[model samples]
Target: MIAQRYSYLSWLPLLLVSSSHPQWPSSWRCIPQPARSSVPCYCSGRQTWAGSLCGTLRIPGKRKRNEIMLRYVVALSLLALSWAQDCQVANINVMQNFDKTRYAGTWYAVGKKDPEGLFLLDNIVAQINIEEDGKMTATAQGRVIILNNWEMCAHMFATFEETADPAKFKMKYWGAASYLQTGNDDHWVIDTDYDNYAVHYSCRLVDADGTCLDGYSFIFSRHPTGLRPEDQLVVLQKKTDLCLLGKYRRVAHTGFCESGTSLDPQ
Candidate 1:
């Protein structure tokens, strides 16, 4: 039976090469081997060709090809998504034609996204005032741990300089005490209803890719308790737009800095 099979297969090359089998690949040649041999017959190239003709021929079929194509498609899709969500700092939008008068007064920090080397921890509150010359100045109080483990209520003040965009300002801030954090930061009002909620953003460091490397955000509310139910949805949407949605932690108002005698920044 083995001899007969081999004899029958030995004519495969002549059959394949015949004009009657014009569809057969010219590169493929069937050279019959011993039945006990692992490769009884083969086609040329890296891929074992003519898989349908040779039952033992190991070749990548339609399913495997589809899998390879699918993998490429998935990788490209992920790369595109990453590009879409790059969160470029220059592309971030701030409030249009922001009214300074409407934005003044006390704002309670309801949610906060902290930056690297965060100073404020919780119980944050900000008081904004417009000076007689229409300059904006703010005073903020928050709980902070400095000198490694010494916790204290921080009294901070900031003076904002006008920029080309009304909603954007360059903030020069310093703590009342010498031990507190002090620096110049970019202040942008992302969104503000003035009467209810306001979103503030600051980027301390921008990466080479035009994305914010070190930044912070504050979700402020007119009320001390936090944003109202209806306003929560609006704030949530703003948080998502800022790309700092899940990065925020609730800012508690435990009155840690409220009762403390805050020193006036000279």
Candidate 2:
């Protein structure tokens, strides 16, 4: 069987909605309807390509109620030079080589980059799986050794994103950290091995006016439990093309992960 390892979440726009993959059952989660924005965005839950925010994802219609909101945002972004700055995008491969049918299951995270405030994600792991109707599921878990500050509620939820063309379909994340639906960012799946074990994530920056910024990239993989740590690291290193900002580290073992900053990393 070909390993459909290519799965990672990307940023979602406020108008769109989607999800990350967790080893989930074949049932799709019904998202809450979006609050309704004048200009909709594409969003997901996976740090990169989880899913867009909402009960269902299809570019939301511009609400008559939010028409003013849309005009204001477009005008504002058009004037900012920063908004014009190049955006961070991914060179991720949309693992189209394999049948999407094979990638329907779960995965765990074993490593990640250690940024100044991201300690909450250290030792944190994520699960990935696909639903039969075309939705994706992501179950994120983190073990914070100490309760200190590096702990937050863990989460398990299901939502929908994109899987249109296996080779061309990429992932994106959006909305509240806990709600997988709402405001969003734009992350794209830039690279993936046809075998589906490894994937690269990147996204355009989210500017002050809600526009995408320069593109940045990261390598996400099945936990070391699935791939050899050394081998996974090798694959990561080979992706030097990614030019990541920092090095990978174990997520802080915050035993409290599940719901939100208000909850824990269960």
Evaluate model 2: give its lDDT: 0.40
Candidate 1 wrong stretches, greater than 4 Å: 1-83, 261-266
Model 1, residue 105: what's the lDDT? 98
Give the winner by lDDT: 1
lDDT of 2 by residue, 79-120 (tens): 573444433333333444544445444444444533222223
> Please, what is the whole-model Cα lDDT of each candidate in the order they appear?
0.77, 0.40
TM-score, per-candidate, Cα-based: 0.67, 0.43
TM-score of 1: 0.67
Which residue runs does candidate 2 get wrong by more than 4 Å?
Answer: 1-98, 113-120, 143-150, 156-158, 163-196, 204-230, 252-266
